[model samples]
Target: GATDADAAVAVAHPNIALVKYWGKRDEALFLPVTGSLSMTLDIYPTTTAVRLIDEPADVVVLNGRPAVGEAYTRVARFLDLVRSRAHRTEHAMVVSTNAGPTGAGLASSASGFAALATAAAAAYRLDADDRALSRLARRGSGSASRSIFGGFVVWHAGDGDGTAGDLSSYAEPIGGEALDPALVVAVVDHASKAVSSRDAMRRTVATSPFYRPWADSSEIDLVEMQKAIARQDLPAVGEIAERNALGMHASMLAARPGIRYLSPQSIAVLDAVLALRADGVAAYATIDAGPNVTVLCARADAARVTAALRAVGDFVDPRTAHLGPGATLVPGED
Candidate 1:
């Protein structure tokens, strides 16, 4: 009954974590140790299409090239999950593209897996709601769960039994619509980092002395962050985000081999953020697992924030992004 005509396409945007979760408790299930909060951005979305094929193996194309090695393997494994759920035998042809640089700490995998999970679930005729879809996306990438929702989203780190935890862990949109902030992304490096986030996280969890302390402190920060968002306090939110990110990096620095993602240029952007605050501007910076820095500020201050980042370094290419909608199926795109 299944045919190539049974195809689906979906698009999803990247998200930057304000209160980030670093390590995982269950690596196989991709369950995080702590919950994280993020804001989905309007820029650099990934669009993916899944078409069932009668062939023996799945075909994967990523950003115009034939997906190979780990990229192809990850896609096939994710589709295998869909197949198991839908009771389908057909392999799929997966095509994915990103509007921005991939694997540069810009949440490329987040958007990619979010779109893939949506498209694959539909193509396999699996009846899934948003919560179910978010869980499915988490199997591919941890941050991808947040990409399933719009605006301010939180990914809950479920506890207790494995089955119950898997069922409970998912992302939902929180109430932060009043802030309407803009995130200025400072592109300090376009190339992918030598160490993947998974590897770095594992190392930090295993060897870092500061990991436990930061995790404990981050729990308190998350509670305070939710209250700040509830009060629509932008400065409070920025302060929490900046300190949380810095604490995460400190944990990384305490690792055995010292996994450092921030560079000189990253420090320069951070300096600019501090200078903006000194001048009474509400700008705060958050760095992911790479050299790039994303500054969160009011939409009115986005231009000022972008200008400051650009002036700091010749390598920094700043782009202003705002809150974006959640993942959706886009019809009529072949």
Candidate 2:
């Protein structure tokens, strides 16, 4: 007999890149090249619901499909990490939905996995804190680790314990802290790309000659980025983030296959950011493993930045934007 508890949770989507965690040091544990920073978006996000049941099999329904086989395996691996801590006996049923369009080049997986991890912990009544939850989410996806908390978050690639090699290990937050509350605006979401994050990272690690440089240089970038956030220096933060993102993508361009996520529209977005900077506007752009670009600006300039981008003619529709809240449990619910 299992004690049934309805656990419904939602997590905002986080666009990561500041000191980008380009290559994983550990594939199994979802470790990263170095530390990374991210801001959870208020617009696109994921919501999930979980219930404890006395069922024979662990079930997960993602966006209405019976998440079986590979999907089940992926989630089960994460649940195993949860169960190792909680020792829960009852099986769970999970249903997850993403607000943004799937394959829209958004960090849907990050938000979706974070919501699932949160919902699972709630359903099992695990008393783990946010750090533990963030660790569990890392086992699912490297970026998901940052989604466990809202605002600016950094995932420090921890040292591996010889089992998964020096690079193969889990990532945790640096300095045992989170980042300041900052807003992230999606400048363009329509230009979805072909390469998935997993594939892109794999290619970059194996083929890119600049991969080593990117990883080696990230340590310095991570330190400065953290300090900038601590000081609330927008310009410093933006400069470090914009450069780090470009460094990550530059590694991709130097890959043996030499593939890039940048499209003409992406270049246009970058140009627009530079144009804004030329006009004395404090704005910058950062991209992950996709063509979509996320602009990092202060809350006050969110409107002006969106308007400027919308006027670029090739931008996506619905130019209005707002600052988002961090991930949290729904009230009187989960």
Candidate 3:
């Protein structure tokens, strides 16, 4: 039997969605109300190691520090899922580190859970294909499903009301080379989010009148975005991405009491992105559940986008990202 001293490690990168996924149809299963499309980025990976132990409870260490509070609970629950799947009662020790700050709306959970799923699955000697692994990652974080693949990926929300089981939701790669682009990440704030994306998502789905519209429009956006990627139409892709992201924010805003993730700095960066477009630089901005903004542009325009964003002074640091690889199990420490 494998001992706690023997660990399995894995690495996975974050992804930014062009077509956003906001609400969940089934929270327990982490099934989204609509499908989403995203590009896995080469920057800011999360490396995780898992070791099954004979202890009574799971242990989690993050970034060289013992994880506590909600973070520890989440990790323990996710490991419980892994243990259940493998039909093993042994608790585990999971240690993970994010290359960048966590919970800054940079999809840290996506990469973290993807890495954890990869490492834990291997450590437990579970037999799962890429699709099954993606589904397993999704149970930890909805966006994590996309991190299981590289390049352009689409997480299908899947069809079912409990009958479809685990197969109902999984992510797969979408083929397209002409539309390969770079993402300019403008880091406005690195602090952990005050209100979790999970809470905001639940509020939006339960109260926002625009929730239905957003879900409906996202379906259309997903189809059109796929076409844009296939044809390598930068303008079409940018337009769809910008509109889809804004629409997602709008839905959240319409929730009861409203959930505003965008800050003044986020808007300022948005202004700079628009100015670059007016100057014939094809740059479009998208944001997640935090104040940071990401600008999508041709790989050749990375410098221009970065410079323009820096000029705005709304971001402390601006970085560039390209298409990244899928999560993988490694023999040694990541």
Top candidate on TM-score is: 1
Q: List the candidate numbers ranked by TM-score, top first.
A: 1, 3, 2
Backbone clash total for model 2 is: 3
TM-score of 3: 0.97
Over 1-334, each residue of candidate 1 has an lDDT whose tens digit, in order, gives 5576689999999999999979998888889989999999999999999998878799999999999998899999999999999999899999999999999999999999999999999999999999999999999999999999999999999875488889988999997899999999999999988899999999999999999999998998889999999999999999999999999999999999999999999998999999999998999999999999999999999998888888997899999999998999997743
Could you tell me the lDDT of residue 233 within candidate 2?
81
lDDT (Cα, 0-100) at 279 in candidate 1: 94
Per-residue CA lDDT of candidate 2, range 220-299, in tens? 89889889878778889889889888998899999888878887877887888899899988888888777777777776
RMSD of each: 1.1, 3.5, 1.4
lDDT of 1 at 189: 95
Better of 1 and 3 by TM-score: 1
The C-alpha TM-scores of every prediction are: 0.98, 0.85, 0.97
Runs with alpha carbons beyond 4 Å of true place in candidate 2: 6-15, 54-56, 68-72, 162-184, 187-193, 318-323
Worst 10 residues of 3 by lDDT: 1-10
After superposition, candidate 3 runs with Cα above 4 Å error: 1-6, 163-165, 332-334
- The local distance difference test score of each candidate is 0.93, 0.71, 0.91
The reply for model 1, stretches above 4 Å from the true place, is none
